[model samples]
Target: MVPTMMLVADSSRDAHRREALCDLADAVARRGEAPVVSSFGTSDELESAVASVDGPLVVVPAFLAGSDRVSAELLAGLDLDQRFDACATPPLGAVPSIVGSLARRLGQAGWRPGDGVVLAADGAFDQDERQQLTSVARMLSRRVQSPVQVGYLDAWAPSVGDAVERLRRRGQRRVCVASWQLVDGAGHERLRELDATAVTAPLWPAGVVVDTLLSQHRAATARLAA
Candidate 1:
C-alpha cells in the first residue's frame, strides 16, 4: 500500500469554516489518490492523528504563505526521524497555481485591464513571511498588468483600507481586492469594511488549487520513497 497523504489546515472554532475545510479535504481526497485525509490546527490534534495512522504519511500544509504559530506547534510536535517515512510539504502559496486562481477570480469579479488591484493576504509579523506576501503581490502585479499593492489582515504596514485609499488617491476609482485566503474567517469578516469596488472570494474549490495540492502530494510521496 502507498503511504497515506494528509493535509494539515488552520483549525477554526467557526463550525462553518471547519466544515468547509473538511469538505475541501474530502473533495481533494476524492479527486486525487491520497489514501487518508486529516487536518489539525493544534499540536495535540496532530499528534493524535499521527499516532492513529500507521505506516508512512506525507503531511502537507494547506497554508498559503509562511508558517504560523499553529503550524510551528505542529512542527515542534512531529519527530520526523522517528517516523522516517513521514515528511511535510511546503505551503500551497509556493506554487504558481495560486497566481492563476487569483487572476481568474479577479476577472470573475469584474476587474478590467486597467483596474487597480490589491492582494490582501493574512499578513505575518515575521519579516520573511511579510516579504513572501510582497513577492506574491508583485507576481500578481505582473499578471494583472497593473500595480497590485499588498495589504495585511493582521500585522505589517498598509491595511486593505489603506491600499484602496492609496489607489483612489491616484485617481483610480475602480479597485478590486483579491483575497489571498483559503477560507473565510474573522480576517475576511474585517474585509467587509474595506472600500473597494469588488472583493473576490477566498481561493477554494478551484481546479488549479486541487491540481496544485495533488502535485504536492505526489512530490512528497516521491521524496519519501527516495
Candidate 2:
C-alpha cells in the first residue's frame, strides 16, 4: 500500500512553492489518491494536517536551495520517531545539484556564466537553517564562477538591495535577480527596482531543476518508505 504522504510547504506563495505543492499532491494522488497536506502559517498546522491521515506517513518538506529553518520548523512539529517514518528533502534552494540545475535554466534564458546574479531567498531566523542557507550559497557561488551573492527577501543579514548595490559598485553590468521563491506569492514583486540591465525571474535556470527535484523527492520518499 502507498504510505500516507504529506507534502508540506510554507503556504502557497506562487512559482516553485506553488509548483512543489501541486506536484507533490499530484504525485501522491496519482499513486493512489493519498492524502497531500499543507501548512501555511505555523508548524502547528502540520499536526492537524498529518493527523488527518492513517497508515505510514511520509512528510515531503517543500524548500528551495539556500533554505532556512522554515521547513525545519514545520517538520519539527511532526513526531518523526513515532507518528511516521519521515524523510526530508532539503530546501531545493540549497542543493549543489540545484545550482547546476539553476545554472542550466539561466543559460537557456540568455544568462551566461559571468552574469552578475543575486540568489535571493526567503530565509529564516534560526541559526542552523541560516547556516544551511549560507552553505548552499557557498556551493552555488562556485558554479556561478562570477559574482553570485546571497540575500534575503525577508530575513538574514544582507537584503536584496544591498547585494545588488554591492554588485553594481563592483562593476557588474548585467545582473539576473534569481528568486528562490517557488510560490506565486507577493514576494516576486520585490525585485521591481532593478537598473534596467538586471534580469529578474525565478531562480530556475531551466526545466531540469524541476525535474531533478521530482526525482530527488521520489528517491527520498522511497527511502523513507523502506
Candidate 3:
C-alpha cells in the first residue's frame, strides 16, 4: 500500500499558521497524494490518525529548520498502539530552492540596491539550528547580491529590531526584513512591529514551499519502497 504523507508542525495558536498548513495539505491532496496535517500539541488527534493508517507513513516536518528535533519530540509526545514503519524527510529550510524564494520575497518587498537586508527568524535554541539559519542568511546574501544580517525573534542575540537599527545607524535609508518563517504567526507579527522599512511575507503560498514538500515526500516514499 502507498504510505500516507503526514505533515506535522509545531503547536501554534495563530490562525494564519493553521490556515497555511491546511492550504498546504490541500495542495498536496490536489496533486493526488494522501496528505494529513497535524500539530504537536494535538496528541490525541495525531495518535488517532497514526492508528488509522494501515501502511508506512512519510512524516514531513512543516518547519523551516530544526525539524529533526520536532520529529523526535512529536514521536516522544505520543503513545502509539504499535510500532509502524515511518520515515521523516529533511526540513524545509534545508531545501536549496528556499534561497530563491527568499530572494523573490525581497524583490516583492521593494528592496533596493543599497537597502540593508536582515533575515529574520524565529530563534532556535539548538546551536545546529542557529547555524543553519546563519547559512541561509549567507545564501540569501549571495543570491541578492547584498550582505544579509541574521536576526532572531526570540531566545537569541541581535533581535530583528536591533538588526534594523544597526543598518539605519550605518546610513542605510531602507532596511528590509526578509522573514525566514514558513508561515505567518507571532514571529511574523513581531517582525512587522519592528522599525524596519519593509518586512517581507513568510515563505508560504510560494510554489517552492509546495514543490519542496512534494519533493521530500517523493524521496521518502522511494526510500520506503526500497
Candidate 4:
C-alpha cells in the first residue's frame, strides 16, 4: 500500500466542524484511503491526537475558519523547500463544491435569479491572492444566475462592508453573504459580525455543503488510487 498524507484544520467546536471533517475522512476511508489529519488547536484536544499518527505528515492548519493564532504560528512553521516529508495538498481553493454549497443555501433561503450574493474569502495581503479571490467570485457569480459580489475584511480590497454598501446602493436588498472560507476561519468570524438585517446570514453553508465536498474528496482519492 502506498502511504499518503491528508490534513484537515479542525479549528472550531461546532458540530458542523466535526461533521465536516469526519464526513471527509469517512468518505476517503470508505474508498480504502487513510490520511493523517494534521490539526492545530488548543480546544478540542484533537490536534494532538492527529499528530501522533505514525504516517506521512501533511499539515493542514485549519484555514476554514480564520485562525489568527494558528496562521501566525503556521507562517513561522512553514517551509517552501518541500520540507515536509509528505505531500500536503494545496489547501482547498474556490472549488466546484463552493458553487454547490451556495446553490443549496440560496435555494433554501428562497433566493431567486436576481438575488445578490457575495462570496467572502480571506482577504490576503498578497495582491495575487486578492486577484485570485476576485476571480473565484466572478466565476461563482456566473455559475449561479444570481449576482455574486466579492467581500473581504482586512488585508484585501473590496472589503465586506464596502461590498455590502456597493450592492445595497445598487438596489439589492435581498443580498446573501456567502462565505467562501473553508468553515471555521476568520472569514466566518467576520461573516458573523455582519448586519443580518441588511445581509442574510443564511449564506453560512459550511454545514450544509459538507457532503457534496466529501464527494469531491472521494473523486480525487479515487483518481489517485487509479
Encode model 1's per-residue lDDT on 1-226: one tens digit a residue: 5778787865646666676678778887887486867765567677788778888888876656732434534564666677887888766663566887888899998899999998887666356566777778888888888999887665556878888889999999899998887766666677767778988877886867777878888888888888
Identify the leading candidate in terms of TM-score.
Answer: 1
Model 4 C-alpha lDDT per residue in residues 90-192, reported as the tens digit of each score: 3444556655665566566556677678766655534444555666676677777666777766555688777877888899876777765544433466677
Candidate order by decreasing TM-score: 1, 3, 2, 4
Off by over 4 Å in 3: 34-37, 66-84
Q: State the local distance difference test value for candidate 3.
A: 0.75
User: How large an RMSD does model 3 have?
Assistant: 2.9
Q: What is the lDDT of residue 118 in candidate 2?
A: 79
Task: Write down the lDDT of every candidate, Cα atoms only.
Answer: 0.75, 0.60, 0.75, 0.52
> What's the C-alpha lDDT at position 90 in model 3?
52
Would you list the rank order by lDDT, best first?
A: 1, 3, 2, 4
Count of steric clashes across candidates, in order:
0, 24, 0, 9
Clashing pairs in 3: none
lDDT of 1: 0.75
Model 3 TM-score is 0.87
